[model samples]
Target: MPAATFEPPAHRGLLTESIARRLQNEIRSGAIPVGAKLPSERELAVQFGASRNVLREVLRRLEAQHLIEVAPGRGSFVIDQSTADARSYDALYRAGRPTVRQLIEARIPIEVEIVGLATSRATDVQIEAMRTANAAMIAATDPVVKARADLEFHDTIAAAAGNPVLRIMLSSIGGMMFEMMLRSNSDPSIAEPGVPHHPEILEAITARDTDRARHHMREHLSLALRTYGPDLDLSLDVMAANHIETLLHRRSTP
Candidate 1:
């Protein structure tokens, strides 16, 4: 079968998401059969009337969803639709009730691997971005601002790793991570000690030392787990109750 073509949307809002959704429909419908090679990035960009960067981001999202596999030198290829559907459903289910312990446990190895990747792959520009984010995190006084900065700081590191799938995976639990940060930052004692490690992790990434980068990333997340993990149990209970209430209300509605 010939490769599918996409028409650009009329509005600009959520362009990347729109493009991803279109491509996802095609893949799921077998218009782009499993094991088939997708059109080149250049071709897809022109077909969608989007910039190459936008096309690339959309492709990354599809890759994250397991709909496509992007080879380094070759083009992208469609994956098994049933397998992709299962993975997507699993990710959605997990995102609905992610626990603090589960987030922390998942972050340890993932962040460690990304930090290592950033050490080798991150550009000077990306490193500078991380530095700026870390500085903002250190200087922010409000708990909410600090928590936002904290997530952005780690997100910068993830971006530097240049793997959108890993970044997306981390982002799936970002809400829980943000809640954990807010709870920790609300307490001066817990937040103060953890502040210094952000720069240490950034410095290790700066030096291109994979081992040290992994070590500092692990140390930072481990400290967070030790300090806030206990309090999170209560928070999770509250969240679970809220979720149940929301579900019940929806069920009771006409």
Candidate 2:
């Protein structure tokens, strides 16, 4: 018997991209751990709200990225991601998508510096941009929107920092960071703790208090790794905590 065909979704690109993001998150988070077989194409299509053709595209993408492998008759399975194949995965920030934990490490020093610079350098317009993004985050009901808004708040600060180089660095990883943010933002346990900090950080930047801005950013970011759980190696968080105490120490300095 010939195989049945699925008419592709109306917004195929959007659906494909969304499925790819979700599958990437699942693979990286170990929900679809290495060597585990993926559900059948029809099953994945239903699970991810995409048509079979769109699911094929997503699977092709993962295969090209070395995130998964497809066997002729055995179905798809997640790869160990031992190496990133640039030829296929190098575009659109897809070359080596960092996990949530990796992005947290990058955010600490980079965002800390960005917030510090933005503190004194941000114009009124830039601060208002941040305000708008934070407001969106506060109002958003969907995890994806909330995650994008969360990243936008930081992006605005990066822009306000007036350091094109720093902004570019953040932009390089923005796509992967959004995926990380979505996973965390989807979790009430993790998202709730991180939400209130944005308003506080925004106010610090508004006040033009570099120390306070950096302090709040450091504390805010230190909590970012909590998604990894109690036993997750948080030496970075510990280092950030030490930096926060050092900032507090400076306050006590005569």
Query: What does the lDDT come to for candidate 2?
Result: 0.71
Candidate 1 lDDT, tens digit per residue, 93-202? 34355566666787898999989998999999999999888888778765556777889988999999999999998777675576567656656657778877888888
Q: What's the CA error at residue 151 for candidate 2, in Å? A: 1.1
- Candidate 1: residue 238 lDDT (0-100): 45
lDDT of each: 0.71, 0.71
Per-model TM values vs. the true structure: 0.56, 0.60
Give per-model CA RMSD.
12.4, 12.3
Q: Candidate 1: where are CA atoms >4 Å away? A: 1-96, 235-254
Compared with the true structure, what per-residue lDDT tens digits does model 2 show for residues 1-254? 11223432323443555567667767866788789999998898777555777788889988876778899999998877645452222233343533446667877899999999999999999999999998998887655567788889889999999999999888866755665565456556767787778888888888888999999898887775655574234333233333333433443357
Off by over 4 Å in 2: 1-18, 22-99, 230-254
Q: Could you tell me the lDDT of residue 2 within candidate 1?
A: 26
